[model samples]
Target: MCTFHGQPCTYLRGPLPRKRRKATDPPEYRSQPNGSGSGSVPGMTHLNLNYPHGLNMTIPLDHHDEVEYPSPELLEALSPSLAGSENLGPAHRQPSLLDGTLGLHLKTHSEYVGLTNYREPCLLDLHPPEDPHTRSVRRLDDFTIFMIHRDRETTSETQRIADLDAIEKVVHPLGASLVNLYFRIVHPSFPILHKKVFLEKYARSYHEFSPPLLAAVYLLALDWSIFDRTLSTSSWQPDQSRLEALALRTMNDDMKRPKISTLQAGLLIQQRAKNNTWTFTSQLIALSHGLGLHVDCSDWAIPEWEKGLRRRLAWALFMQDKWGALVHGKPCLIRPDEDWDVRPCRIEDFPENAADEEHDPEGSAEVVIGRELFLRHIELSLILSDVLRTFYTAKATRRNGTLEQIGTIGVAELAKPIVLMLRDWYAALPEALQLQGTRMKKLSANGSLHLSYTAIDLALHRALLRNVSAVAPPELRHAIRMGARTRLVSAMTIISNLQPEHTQSFWGFMASAQLASIGTFAGLLWATSDDDLEATFYCERVEEYLWSLRVRSQAVPFARDALRMLEAEVGGLGPVRASNLPMEMMRI
Candidate 1:
């Protein structure tokens, strides 16, 4: 954090802009960052190309406003023949970028940088995280909000009492059971909070924790009351509205002095606040950057354990940003090239590990599986980022930030390397992570992990299908259609394997949104099929998936809703063909 007043700021002993890849590390992705020659973050260049402080909007409407309006010039580049004057050469062939904007240029990942926006309340560092508050506090509106302090109606001591009273009123008498339920069921899959640290603090006193965070913990745990037999049968239920209101109020106040707990609370409560999906996620990312969560903390002069916790939290947010973008049809808040610089997490980074299971009584084999599930999710988020970057970027398009793409890029060529990456990822997946067969009795991460893969693959294939044109290379169009179908069928396979146990896992928390996506994939296959026999096969499998959802309808949240979506998606597909031949679909 030391800066020379006379000169441009430089780290005396701090880590580099971002971490670089080492020789020992496996080269998972070969695509390199396109613009910057070196992988270093915008350290001095930002100073050289200095401009007024950047302002991030309080509302997540920046990307929303970047709608591309076609001018005559762009119209020609995207559809030259449509201009009625330009020649449709090899480069400007029909079914150009218009077919399906399928183009990818990738870059290899670098080493992990230290914390960028991490704000340690009291501790000072000789070599602190590279990204400090000064460096990341770019957005004017955000900084303005951060600076504004409201007039208080009461003294600090009185406010603290009031906050505690509010929390105590909402918290259950057997809050310990609820906390235990969270660790047992949810923590394994989503390890945003350090179990040891959280338990230690709660044991000391509820007041030891932030008000928002404390309320958030109990509130989230209550969602799974059924898991606790006693809580399930009890006549009393929590006042969810009150707890949520208190969390929201305290959350706003806590932002004045942000901490890791703030992020933990934000991520936990993200599920309940369905109305604020886009704005809330955007705010979380902004807060994280300001707190330096995006910076690598490998070389930070912090406790080794804290470093591990930081890495876990950082990746958790990373997963949130990538998935949120795809689900909401919004742009990702974090950028891989300049924004990310952390090393891939190792087994030691995760709080729960196999060796620790034997030492603690509460620790079980589930902890071991849960950590594996979490790590795998982080890896999948990396792949999903590439999918968004490679195929969905504005590299080939004329506009900088618009979603409306206009390019003549090779869609099939772009998919090959990513396709290989996905294949290798699945091949390298640990056998322990592989769950029981379809409809297996036990529930591990099998369904969530499998379905996640299907969703991402569907994204890749679906993009290709959109580019399918009569004038496009027949082979390319045919291949894209088949790949999409394969992904649709993959969705069915994952859906069939789902059990009641999965509904309680981390993925289960977001099941409603994901279930809608599954329906979309099935619908894409059903609506786009030119062949009647092939369409029938998709319809039958989708119906089977509907039946599966119906069986789990009572136990799972929004299962009935998903079932209805699938019914509407396939039922309204198109004119029903005469019941003639099932062989049209039976053929592989």
Candidate 2:
């Protein structure tokens, strides 16, 4: 996909023979959503500006075959609060924390293009069916070639030998074709010695590629594999080691992006308030993952996709220094924030008179709801802080050649400072939330725990996004957006079901934060020690207590189910399975 005047587009390959199929056939396929569950609504689908005639489109069989499409009126009735939002406000004109010198001044315009925005997407001529159909035919710069063999059909051992032999036969041609494709996708800037080139050359001789190159190919394969599985509902399991290696490489790549000086990120937050596109701001909840935020809905027995979206959105808000409230008539921390040593600014504190994207005060109801959702986004940077520390430390150790033990005390030690920061923020909860007498009758009493847990989960979500985004190619940014959107939708749906009066109340925030925090701590603590027996005991007890507290247990099937899956995957004593323990200990 290419960014044209800041908008994104997927360029189709040159004109090909067109044989119209019957109307009953599925529509032509476009790109797939980067998430699962409750696929994108129709109206929101990208406008086919390039095809006035309207290109054919196809909905997945799982969703399309079984679920009826929403009627136009029904779609119109959807909560505008769910529409995507982007903070495309004008750039912050002020000096930022990271702006060390005048020369270091980063551009703050809507036109600003970061490394993430670099891609020229021209769709390839290859349109292989979801499954292996006819022989694969890929178009090279100079000629079209038929695949001698499908990579998927080969075993690892035979594939290695085949690749070695294949390199001797087609390496020179394959390398040239690859370079041509690379230039088509992105500008060519690196010297011949760049690792990317070296890796690509080595990729021809699959056995000769270094760990990083192999990891990149694995990640690309994973992305393709996941997309195929999601769209086709085919269960294709990848080697766990391959997934881990891919994740590690992606994390390292993310660190290389001119680190958005903390000051720059902060400035973007403030500037976004005044100049961002209404879509970005309104879509805050959905874009939470894109921004490396989290959502924690472990208390709820909701769809996994929804839960993950909410957690990420909450964390994104937290990262932007936009959550908190008054305690004892004094300022206090509501969501974790890095700007405040004690607490940070809340949504209510946003500059009221800042420029808005939709100048029309009387816009559609969807626009209004979108604005409201943006304002309600959870703000918790503590999650990102923890995630970064956790991922980097684990990665550093792994790079040192200790793959046998990935998560250990050394990793947990790296994570402790960030966790302590969260603890400190929780300690600053309002007097009502902390006091025994007031807690018995107020929202704080019932909701504080859940909110605390949600806060921590938001952090974890952010970390995971960071981990994935770090290694993902620029082409996969859409997937990242999908990931963030799914989480936002889930969180909003969960909150919408709550007592409307309490949805924005301190207790409400506290409840969500509490649930996320619990999940985060549970995961991290469990990640620390190698003793599966002990971890299982803790997980089971915690799960039981969380269920007992009526912490919206139905809102987060992803984390819960993943835990179960992980247990099954890991086998033996682990976070997934443990002797059913009492909820009593978890409360403490």
- Specify the highest-TM-score model's number: 1
RMSD per model, one decimal: 21.5, 24.6
lDDT of 1 by residue, 1-588 (tens): 235456554533323223333445432221112111121231111111211112111111112232223345644664454443233222232211011000000000012113342533222223344543212111111111011111122125356557856786776565666777677666777788766545533543455466777788788788777667657888887798898889888878765555567778888877553523877889888777655667666654333456677788889888888888887777778898886876777877775555444432222126677787788888888999988886665553224323223321366667778889888988887777765532233235556787777778878876666554446766666777777776666676665666555554555334555676776676666656667876777677666677778887776656766666656655445434423325333121
lDDT of 2 by residue, 225-288 (tens): 2122232253434453543444344323322221112222222222211222333333332233
lDDT of each: 0.58, 0.30
Which regions in candidate 1 have their CA more than 4 angstroms from the true location? 1-157, 272-276, 355-365, 394-409, 437-443, 508-510, 531-541, 564-571, 576-588
- Which parts of model 2 are misplaced by more than 4 Å? 1-110, 113-379, 390-394, 397-413, 432-588
Alpha-carbon error at 495 in model 2, in Å? Answer: 13
TM-score (C-alpha) between model 1 and the true structure: 0.68
The deviation in Å at residue 414 for candidate 2 is: 2.7
**Best by the lDDT measure:** 1
